[model samples]
Target: MTREEFIAAIAPAAVKLRLEGSPLFPSVRIAQAILETGGVIPAWNNLVGYKVGSGVLTPYWKGRSVNKSTWEVYDGGETRVRADFRAYDSVEDSFRDQDLLFDLERYRRVREAKTPGEQIKALLAGGYATDPDYAKKLDQLTEQYALTRYDKEVDDMLEQLMEQIRLLQEEVRALREQKAMTEIPVWAQEAVQAAAAAGILDTTTGGSYDFYRFVTILHRLGLFDAKGQAG
Candidate 1:
C-alpha cells in the first residue's frame, strides 16, 4: 500500500484509541500497524498482527480467523509455528484488542510510562514482540511520519471533517450532473456535438449522470475501442 493509503486506513483506529483514554500513544499504535502488517492493508482487517493463543477457530473469537505460519523469538533464538491470528469485522475491532493487551499485568509498566519511547520500552520489556529491536522500529516509523498527528484529532473533530467531506462530494456530484459536452475543449466538444447530432450519445436520462453512462456514450460513438485485457 502507498504511504497515504496506510495513513488513511489507520487514522480512525488511532484516533479512537486516543479518545477511549488508552495510555498507548496513537503514534505507537499506528506504527505498530505499519510494522506488523508490512504496510499492506489486508482483506482480513487484522490491523495489529494479534495472534490467538489457542489453535482452534472457536465461536468464542466472535470473528473469522486465518492460520498462517508465524515466527516466535526469545533470548533463546527463533522458532516457526503455524498459529491462528485474531480476525476482525473491521480494523477498529483489532485496534480495540491491542488496547486490551496493554492492560494485562505484564504491560503495567507501559500504562505507567509517560513518553512514547518509554511506553515502547515498557512493551519490549514486557516481551510484547519477539523482535529484539521492536521498540526502535516502532520509534522510527512514528518519528519519520509524525503519526502522532492522529492522536490529537478528537472524535468530534473527526465527525465534523467527515460531514464536510460528504457535503463536498454531494456538491461535486450535483455540478457534474449539470455539465454538458460543451464544457470540454473545443476539439473534444465538436466531436461530442457531432456524436450527439448523430444520435450516438444517449441524451435520454432519468436525470442522472454516472461514469458508466459516459463510458457507454464513448463506446457508442466509437471513441473507446480497446480489445486488450487488463489484470
Candidate 2:
C-alpha cells in the first residue's frame, strides 16, 4: 500500500483504541507503524513489530508467529537477527495487541503521559526500543506527517460522547424529579382520595405538594368526606 493509504487505513483503528481508553495517542501509534514497517503494511498485520516472546499470547494475538529478520541495537551497534514476530488476522488486532503491551505495569509512564511527546519519552525510558535515536525518529515522523491531528480527532469524539452522556443523565434526573412531583405523599393520600371521590378534586395525580396539603386540610375540615359528599 502507498504511504498515505497505509496511514488512512490504520488511523481510524488507532483513534478507536484511544477512544476505548488506550493511553497511547493516535499520532504515536501511527508513527510506530510507519517506522516499524517502513510505511509498507505487511500482509501478516504486525504493524508494530511485536515479537512472539516465549510463545506468550494475548487475547488479540492468538499465538501465531512468523520468523522474520529484524535489527536490534546491541553493544553500541546495529545487529540483524532472525526472530519470531507475532502475527494477526487484521490491522485492528495488531493495534489491540500493542495496547495490551502498554497495559503492563512497567509502561505506566507511557499510560500516564499527557501528550504524544511525553508518551514517546516514556516509551524510550521504559525500554520500548533499543535504538538510542528511536524516540527522536518517532518524534520526527510525528511532526513531518502532522499525525497529531488524529489525536485531536479522538479528543473531539470523546467530548461529543461525554456531552451525549451528560444529556442522558439530565433526562433521567428530570424524569425522576417529575415522578416525585406527581406522586401523592403518604400523609395526603387518604384526603386526596376522599376529595377525588366527592368530586371536590378532578384528579388525584400531578398535584404540587402544597396543593395536596390544601386538599388534605379541606378534607379534615369535613369539606369532603369518605361518603363522597361535599360539606
Candidate 3:
C-alpha cells in the first residue's frame, strides 16, 4: 500500500482503539511500520518489528543473510534457525495484533490511561520497546501528525463542563449574597441579646459595641461562613 493509504487506513482503527484505552498511538504505529517495512519495500507485509531468522530458510523469505549465524535456543532443545521472518495477511491484522499486545495483563496500566500522551508515557516507562528513546520518538511522531487533535471533541466537552461549573458558582454566590443581606440584621440582634444575657457585652455605657466585632463573632460561630473551605 502507498504511505498515505496505509496511514489513512489505520488512523480510524487507531482512534477507536485509543478511545477504548489503548497505549499505542496511531502515529507511533504508523511511523514504526514505515521504518520497519520501508513503505512497501521487499514486498513483505510484516509491520510488527519482526527480524530475520538465524537459520532455517522458509519459502516466504528467499533472501540471503550477510552471514549464516545461530542464536540462542529455547528449552525444547530446538536449534536456533536464522532466516527471513514471517509475513502478515494484511496491515489491518497487524494493527489488531499490536493493539492486542498492549491489552495484555502486563500492559494494563497503559490501557487504563485517559489520554494518548499518558498511554504513550506509560508504555515507554513500562519498557514496552527496546529503544531507549522510545518516549521521545513517540512524542515527536504524535506532534508531527497532530495525533492529539483526535481528542478535540473531548476537549470541547470539558470546556462546556467548566462553563457550566462557573455559571453554577455565580448562581450560588448570588443566592448567598441575598440570604446574607436578609438574615444578617436578625442574626446580629440575637447575638447582642445573647451577649448581654451572658454579661459578655457592656450595655450600661454601650462600651465596645463594634459592628465588626459582632461580625467576627458571627464568623467564629460558623454562622457567616456556612460553606467552610469552599467559600
Candidate 4:
C-alpha cells in the first residue's frame, strides 16, 4: 500500500485508540511502519517486524535467524531453533497488532498517556528509543501527517492532565513541609553542611540548588575546569 492509502486505512483506528488510550502510539507506529516496511504500509503485509527462519521454504521466505539461542529452557530444546513468522493476511491485522503490542506493560507509560502528543513525549522521555532526538522526529512526523487533526476531540485532555499534575505537586509540597517541620534528621543536617561547604545549596531554605548554576557562578570566578567539570 502507498503511504496515502496506508494512512487512510489505518489512521482512523489509530486516532480512535489514541483518544481511548494514548496519543504517542500512532507516531511510534508510523515510524516503525516506515522502518519495518520501508513505507507507511508493509511490502508483504508483515507489519510486526517479523523475521522468517531458515527452515521456511515458502516463496515468501524473506531470510533466516535463530529463534531462541539461550539455554534457559528446561526441556533442552534445539539450541538453534528456526521458526516462521506470521505474514499478515491484510494491512488491518498489522495495525491491530501495533495497538496490541503497545498495550504490553513495556509500553504502559505511553499506553496510559491522555493525549497523542503527551504519549509521544512520554515515550521519548522514558527512553523508548535510543535516539536523542526521537521525540522531535516523532513530533515532526505527527505534524507532517497532520495526525493531530484526528485529535480535535481530545484537544483539552492534555490541559486536564497538566492541572491534575499541578494539584499532585501541591499536595506533595505540603506533605514535605509537614515532614520538615517535625524533624531535622542527622542526614538532613549533614546534607546542609555539605551544601554549605560546596556552596551548591541555599543555606537559609536548605533547598538543593542546581549544580550547573553554581558551576556557572564558579566559572565567572575562574574556578571551572576546561571541560566544565568542577575544578
Candidate 5:
C-alpha cells in the first residue's frame, strides 16, 4: 500500500488503541507501523512487523504466523533474513496484540513513557528493533506525517468527556439542594406540626429552609391563636 493508504488503513485502530488507555501514543504507533513495513502493508495484517517470539496465543492472535524475508541490522551491517512474523485477521487485532506486548516486564518503560519521543527511546532501550537508526527513522515519519494530531484528538475527546462528567455532578448537586430546601428539617419539624394542626399551613412541605425558620419563629411568638387567627 502507498503511504496514504497505509495510514488511512491503520490510523483508526492506532487512535482507538491510544484512547483505550494503551500507553503507546497514537503518533508513535502509526510511525512504527510505517517504519516497520516501509508503507507496504503486508497481506497478513501484521501492521508493525510483529514476530512470533515466545508469546502465547491470545484472543487477538491465534498462533498464526507467516515466514517472511526481513532485514535486521547487526554489527553496523544490514542483512536480509527469513523470520517468523505473527499474522492477524485484522489491523485492529495486530494493534491490540502489539499493545499486549507492553505488559511484559521488559516493556515497563515503554508503558510508563509519557511522550512520543520518550516512548521511542523506551522502545529502543527495550530492543524492539535491531536497527541502530530506528528511533530517528520513526521520528522522521512521525514529524513528516503530523501523526501527533491523532494524539491531540484523543486528548480533546478525554477533556470533553471529563467536562460532561462535571456537568452531571453539578446537576446532581443541584437536585440534592432542591430536595433539601423542600424537606422539613428536624429543628423546624415541631413548628411545622403546630402550624398544620392549627390549620394555618395548607401543607407541611415544599418550603425553603429560611421559610421554615420564619414560620417557626412566628409560631414561637404565639402569633396564631388556637382558632388559626392572629392573636
Candidate 6:
C-alpha cells in the first residue's frame, strides 16, 4: 500500500494505542512505524518492525518468527545481519506489543521524557534503534505527515466538552437562584423603590430586574447591614 494508505489503515489502532496512556506520543509512534515498515508493511505485519530478543525468539517459543537480513549498526558502522524477527498474527498485535518496551528502563525513560524530541532521544539512547539519525528521521516524519493532528483533535474535543459542562452548570445556578426568589415581601419591594428613588441601588434595569439581583445590589450598597436582611 501507499504511504498514505498505510497510515490511514493503521491510524485508528495507533490512536487507540496512544490513548492507552503510553508515554510515547502518537505522532512519534506513527513516524517510527512509517520508517520501519517502509513498503514492507503487509509482508511483515510488524507495525513497529520489532526485533526479536526479549526471550520470545527462542527455538521453543510458541510465536511466529521470520528470518530476515536487517541493517545492524554496531561499533560506529553497520552490517547486514540475518536474524529472526518476531511476527504477529495481525497488525494490531504488532501495534499492541509496542507496550512491551515499557519493560525496559530506557523505554521508561523515553516515556518519562518531557518533550517529543527528548522522547525520541531516549529511545535512541536506550538502543531502541541503531541508526544515529533515528531521532531526526522520526521528528521529520512526524511533522511531514502532521501525525499530531489526531492528538490535537482529541484534546480540542475534550476542552470543548468541558466548556459546555461549565456553561450548563452556570445556567443551572442561575435557574436555581431564579426559583429561590419566590417570596420577596411587599415591605422589601417598598424598600427597593425607596432605595432606587434615593439612587442607592446600582441598577440601570429601571427597577424591573430579578428579586435576587435587587437583594444583592442592596447588599453591595450596605443597605442590608451585616445580617443580610435589609435594615
Which candidate ranks first by TM-score, i.e. highest?
Answer: 5
lDDT, candidate 6, residue 152? 73
Which candidate do you rate higher for TM-score, 1 or 2?
Answer: 2
Cα shift from native, residue 10, model 1 (Å): 1.1
Candidate 5 backbone collisions, by pair: none
Q: Whole-model lDDT, candidate 6?
A: 0.71
lDDT tens readout by residue for model 3, 1-231: 776666666566655654555566555566555545545533345565544435433433334323223343345344655544544455555555556566568777777776666776777666565555666776776676665565564455567879999999999988876655444354356554555455544434332335536644764575533323211
Residue lDDT tens for model 2, 170-222: 99988876876778889988887788788767673567777888888898898
Candidate 5 per-residue C-alpha lDDT over 36-155 given as tens digits, one digit per residue, 9 for 90 to 100: 888877779898888999868988999999999999999999999999999999988998988888898899999998899999989988989999899999999999999999899899
Off by over 4 Å in 4: 16-28, 31-40, 47-86, 125-128, 153-231
Q: Kindly indicate the candidate among 1 and 4 with the higher lDDT.
A: 1
From the highest lDDT down, the ranking of the candidates is: 2, 5, 1, 6, 3, 4
Best by lDDT: 2
Residue 79 miss distance in model 3 (angstroms): 22
Model 4's alpha-carbon lDDT is 0.55
Rank the models by TM-score, top first: 5, 2, 6, 1, 3, 4
What is the TM-score of candidate 5?
0.84
Q: Judge candidate 2 at residue 13 and give its lDDT.
A: 93
Instruction: State the displacement of the C-alpha of residue 188, model 4, in Å, after optimal TM-score superposition.
Output: 73
For every model shown, what is its TM-score relative to the native structure?
0.60, 0.83, 0.43, 0.41, 0.84, 0.65
Q: 3 or 4: which has the higher lDDT?
A: 3
1-231 per-residue lDDT for model 4 (tens digits): 676676666666555555665434555555545544445553446654544423443433323332422221224432433444545555555455445555657777776776666787776565444455656776776777776665563456666778999999999998886665554454456444444556554555533334334434554565534443334
For model 5, the stretches where C-alpha displacement exceeds 4 angstroms are 185-188, 195-231
In model 6, the runs with Cα more than 4 Å from the true position are: 56-62, 160-231
Model 2: CA > 4 A from native: 191-205, 208-231
Each prediction's whole-model lDDT (CA): 0.72, 0.89, 0.56, 0.55, 0.87, 0.71
Superposed by TM-score, candidate 2 places the C-alpha of residue 81 at a distance from the truth, in angstroms, of 1.9
Q: Taking the tens digit of each residue's C-alpha lDDT, what string does model 1 give over 62-123?
A: 65788977787866688898888887777877777677777789999988988778888998
lDDT of 5 at 169: 100
